[model samples]
Target: MKSNRVSTRGILVTLCADESRVGMPGRAAPQGKLTGIGVKPIGEVQWQLLYRWLYGVVELLSGEHFMLEMSHLDSLCFEAFLQTFAQTYPHQLHLIQVDTCLST
Candidate 1:
């Protein structure tokens, strides 16, 4: 009997970015001080399984916000993040089949 197996030729990729304020109650809250960028598989299961391998974080001062403005260093970090994503591509592709059709 022939072996049943599938090879992973390619995988789905996704990129994400967001910013939020972080500070203790006593300390002054900086606007958009924390930012993160990451790449991961499209599905929730895969993302949860391996999110650490593809992400970057940056701390910015009050003057910086991701889209409206970005420092030169921030741009470099973003470039590095893209490079990391390309370098750390997933090794395996997960396939899922769903059956939700109802017969009339």
Candidate 2:
């Protein structure tokens, strides 16, 4: 049997569960949009912190889309990136399994 694997590049967006919004940034804003706050990756530690913050925001606001921007990454590192992201934001963001076609 051949192992079939799908290749995807770009952000992964997900919706969080309802009834968990409190003190979360962008809670009062529109759906599928990030809050006015900006995320800057100062270093690896700061990057992780930003990721956690983004995950929290996504988790509180259900029906809102959370995007994982992956354009900067190569296909070979996609899976590892996804795994790390998922682990960091476990049970916070719900993964929406769907394939997206991009024309470049």
Candidate 3:
């Protein structure tokens, strides 16, 4: 038995996402004194690799497409994106597909 509730908003947003990274700062150097310097990051991480991600969805009913870009991707970033998407499309359902491994 299911509840007799149907949403008037007829949109199923299916999103596919990919993340790519670039500009890793020329072999990367440590923020602190180097112990024989072999590209080891010690102490606080001062440099970050630039990352670009694209998450997009197309609404079949309305033919509307939206793509989102960000510098990096993490649990925090994912949450923020979800919040923004929800605020923007309060009535639409979202489906996100991740195609990359998030760096730890």
Candidate 4:
């Protein structure tokens, strides 16, 4: 925008995005404790019975949201998501809002 002229587009979009890469329920973190009368958990292993992964975002301007279930958290998944999003949105811009910290 110039000093004397203001410019706007037809539709400018922003998004608040997030992802969850857990396979099964209660697998990302332990939901309960396994205590047995002062028993130690030295040799215990947390089972990651995984299944599905998800990436999601909500459009801040429209309150609309989209969720995609992908394989896992890797560059391949991210690239694929970018391709799909570009194909669907077509030159639209987005801002993901995960872990957003602003310092002065």
Per-candidate TM-score against the hidden true structure: 0.25, 0.25, 0.46, 0.54
Q: Any runs in candidate 2 off by more than 4 Å, and if so which? A: 1-61, 71-74, 92-95, 100-104
Q: Is candidate 2 or candidate 4 better by TM-score?
A: 4
Q: List the residue pairs that clash in candidate 3.
A: none
C-alpha lDDT (0 to 100) for residue 69 of candidate 1: 22
Candidate 3 C-alpha lDDT tens digits along 1-104: 00112134445555555444544454344545666758764565556555576545454555455556766657676667667667767765777676667466
Positional deviation of residue 92's Cα in model 3 after best superposition, in angstroms: 1.1
State each model's CA lDDT, in order: 0.31, 0.33, 0.56, 0.60
lDDT pick, better of 1 and 3: 3
lDDT of 2 by residue, 3-46 (tens): 11111211333433211212323333233334345865343321
Give the range where candidate 2 is weakest over 10 consecutive residues by summed lDDT.
Answer: 1-10
Note the clash tally of each candidate. 0, 3, 0, 2
Give the clashing residue pairs of candidate 2, or none: 11-68, 12-68, 13-66
Candidate 1, lDDT over the whole model: 0.31
Q: In candidate 2, how many Å is residue 50 off?
A: 23
For model 3, the superposed segments whose C-alpha errors exceed 4 Å read: 1-9, 22-52, 58-64, 100-102
RMSD of 1: 22.0
Candidate 1, residues 13-81, lDDT tens digits: the string is 222344222322342333333435664434332111211222232212222111222222344644564
